[model samples]
Target: MSPIFMTLLLIVTLGVFAYTANRRWRLLMVGAADKRSDRVGDRVRATIEYAFAQKRMRRYPLAGIAHQVIFLGFLVLAIRSLILFSRGYVEDSSLILFAPHTVIGDVYSLLKDVFVVLVMLGTLVFFYYRLVVKLARMTLSTEGAIILGIIFVMMVADVVYDGAWINLRARAAGAEVTFSGWEPVGSVLALLFQDAGDGVLRCLAHVGFWTHTSLVLVFLNLLPRSKHFHVITAVPNVFLQNLTPRGRIAPIEDIEGKVEREETLGIKRIDQFSWKSILDFYTCTECGRCSDHCPATNTGKKLSPKHLTIDLRNFLYQHETALINPSRDRKGADAENAEYAKDLVDGVIDPEVLWACTSCRACETECPVFITYVDKIVDMRRYLVQERGEFPNELQTAFRSLETSMNPWGFSQDERGQWADGLNVPLISEKPDAEILFWVGCAPSFDERAKITTRATAQLLQRAGVEFAILGPEEQCTGDFARRAGNEFLFQTLAEANCGVLNGYNVKKIITTCPHCFNTLAHEYPDFGGNFEVIHHTEFLARLVREGKLVPKNRVERTIAFHDSCYLGRYNDVYDAPRDVLRAIPGVKLVEPEQTRDRGLCCGAGGAQMFKEEEPGDERVNHMRTEQLLATKPDAIASACPFCIRMLSDGLGDKERTDVEPLDVADVLLRSVEENVPAEQTAGA
Candidate 1:
């Protein structure tokens, strides 16, 4: 390649790359203010682990190895790209080259040859996935194939370039000499060209060199324009990941003021997302791991989280000029705004798609790049529910019931303690000095199917000799469903009300039968100025058993398969406590459904799915999860959440597995405990 042409190519390619990259930076600037740099130490560690080490990618073995090879190859080949560029400027870029005879350079040459082959091998694996295996979890695109093809060619060109150079150097010395040992892969290839004329070998050298060098620039400029942009953004995106508790939803700040100002309640436009979210969109690898695990997607719903992010990202990129250029929409409102806004609610994202999410966090958990989907979906829902009043009609009833009765069932709050009427459960109003306040959630209080679990929990607490009282009429819904459904206003009202009641009673500890209530009180309530030591009934029972406060001496003798509720297991990390409680019971053997713990499927009741009809799907999420559990062939299924129990029990009836009962952990414990109470004590005169 000529020096003048090479130099011009370098200048032009760098100029194009810089211009396109700067355009992305300004587009990111259009997003809402977000602070991600606070925890610098954790950020760096995460970047090195998830980005440098490719931690999450390892979940899929074949793809993991292939990706790691390509990632490491890029890091090593980056130096080679730089060295080639420098050669275009200087006659002998000896400092940059690993040309023969120098000790360090010779070692580098051998290593480069080995990596060239390794990288090409890695490319073949991905090519197999793209062209042959065609994994459904991955997006198939011509652009992806083109990028992989270019990378494959680059690796081959590097080795071929060295092979051609080896032949040229040997012939220049006027000897039929064997190739040097330092060029392992290249030396092997050079032998084939030993009989070739000098002119042919020289032509091969120019072709290999120009092909390798020119393609580097072409690939560089193409990166920001494709999903392959993750090559540059994934590391930074990992570093900027949200560090909040996994179970907590970031609260809406200054809700009253935002309402008064008539500002966008949620994400009314693409620009309303935080810059970190924009990075999330850019960092998606087009790997559908999120949607693969997503209950909504698995059950044939219209919500594919990967496609959602890509759609929003493409929309933002397409309207970059109006968003980044202040002169176009300076006042944040212009007649041209219609072209810019595009109504994020129903225009960019469908209403059915927004409502379809179970908020199981399966999408978030499976995302190798840490791209979040729940927050984005909820944000869109917030806009539709609060600003536009255009959510699914069923949600309107749930919201109305929440506002009036403080429960979705619209039952009398006074009857909350009726489930434990025979168990002597005291109302918090009557026994405010009790050790722990038992928050009998709406489901357990109002839903007849859930009251059995509620009664069992109260009885177990009593058997443990743990002084506890029910909030009864004073207790309200924890707002977990409302908030997740995108009605932030209703959620906030309920949160503030619950917080006020708890604070007024000077409550310091609470035990909940419902994971939804436990998650909200322990994680979400603190944001509303209500902080307490909250425990799920399973955790409470496990602690009591550990302390010898309760003893399970009777042998129920049932092979039990444990169902992990997404909220209890994935959201709150309470997986072990429930299992431990089940394990401690004598003659109780615990079996696991294939998808348990972090990978547990949603029970289909999360994200306010409990309050409305499921969006169109081939199979109910609960039914799918139930089938997986029943495959274990347990005599009974034990769960720690009311929602899980409800869903699984319903599934049992549907599948005619009524012989396989779904029992709450509390129910199992109550049945297992011996006759510890004296007759007079039980009478409680």
Candidate 2:
């Protein structure tokens, strides 16, 4: 064959291979669109700014810079290789800028050489981190390490070929290429190549060039088939994130009727997941960021959100052929199918891992790629409860209570008003025309510690002159526990009943001290067509202070650490209002824990974990949070959610350290007001 024909044939063969590989990758990635809505413009911008420009990576400055350099090097090297391929074999002198003399070509060669060295060093550092240093709780599986080695080898070979080719060409032209300033390595290699025949050097160049190109193409083809698919999916996931209310789960519009349908309520199989959920599986970088922040994982629980996603992905991949081609039967087919059936008791996911999650959203918050781990977990819980009739044994009683009496504790519905027995609080049923209804949640009315918070809130409301009436015996549990525990059916029943009661009355607004109650009433109730303006006591009190309805008369001089409740803080984004209330109290200096707001650790009370026993783990979630709070060394620890108050209080009690007191936000405000109430005229008696 003529040299010209050989060059054309090589170009055509490589081009076809590249196109075919890329097309397959696109086909695999196309399935990621179902869960997430399209925001193409936003995706493009985020991809450029974040994925390509390394915005999020920059948060870890040293590693970020190293990655950015390597990324840029890959881009530059790719362009240089294309230029070399076009010129070397095709006799395309027009593409060879360094043929005779071009300062720009020299500059290009110099910079390319510099970047190749930088890229090599960067890759080495990354390898160490992935396999040795192991930052972000990262570990390299055997396959991962092998892939890394292949990529490293490909890069080194490419750089070596470029240097050798440049040197050979320079010597052929009898041009004494300066070695001191630029292309030092290439200049040395060129001297060695002078002795080798032209044909021999050309053959070596072709071998090196083809090897690099082939490896790069193979890497591209393997990407979507491997964990490295995150490279393409992560950017889009981050950009198209659900920027809506975190506490507000997508409610079932016709909850009762839908359950009667044959359609699945939540994910029962891999294909049952929304495309976004599938994308989440594909987009995970395996960096273990979620596991690093997981309270359950840190506590030695079997539940690692990271591992949960990983396991699901592996299961899906293993069954992909069976799933796509139903006729194809293989060994263990029935067992594998049963394992992915979404019913927790029989599913691959352990009951412990499912229940262990506190729904803290820490995993969601820390996931750099914006994987909504909490949502997926919640969806699985929905499936478990709605279809499979599975849940923790402790939750059985609560579920029964909620079904029978409309409360988790099985308390008499009439007793809901007992929390206000001695107080001047009016019953809303007696005053059906009342403007505001005080929602005294089950915890406050039934649980002793939480009752104090309820009383304090009532007094605060009275002092602020906010007209509010209690539902008394008419109020049932808001069904927050039942819903979170995965009994969506029970939650819907209670919600419909509660909505019916509220619908009968003329309640324009509702307020509650419990974050769980507040969240459910405010966000979830609307799904049941029971829409009312709702506010947490912390928010209401803060507004009262701001409006000058409640004046801060006394200075409570104590340093207090604020424990952000998972439901109030992460679920509802109510972080500021609680802190604002504390800061408004004169002499009450608010000290924040290291992980405050979105990063705040769970107190292990959400997701019905409060009702059930905690799973075995290295550390209790609440203990971990309490220790962090104690690190602040505050006189008191305050929280807005009653559940958080209960858990943190229990944690503090376990430590046997009485110096740090745990108080609800309401307790703090009420105590401040009581302190300012002067010893009323002693002579009056």
Error of 1 at 10 (Å): 0.9
lDDT of 1 by residue, 1-685 (tens): 4789897898899999999999999988888998887889998999899889999888889889889988988988888887777766663464644655788788887777778878888999999998999999898999999999999999888777767777877777876657667778888878877787878887887788888999999999999999999999988999999888778888889989998997888888888899889999888988999989999999999999988988998898888887888875745557335576768766888888888899899888888889988888888888888888887778888888889999987777777667787777888889989989998899988777678778777887877788988788888898999999999989999999999999999999998889889888988899999999998989889999999998888786889999888888888888899998889999888999898888988889889988889999899988998899999989988888888888888888888886787888887787778454332221100
Backbone N/Cα/C clashes per model: 0, 6
lDDT of each: 0.85, 0.75
CA RMSD (A), model 1: 3.5
lDDT of 2 at 527: 85
Error of 1 at 142 (Å): 1.4
TM-score for each model: 0.93, 0.82
The residue pairs in collision within model 2 are 35-275, 35-276, 299-617, 299-618, 299-619, 300-618
Best by lDDT: 1
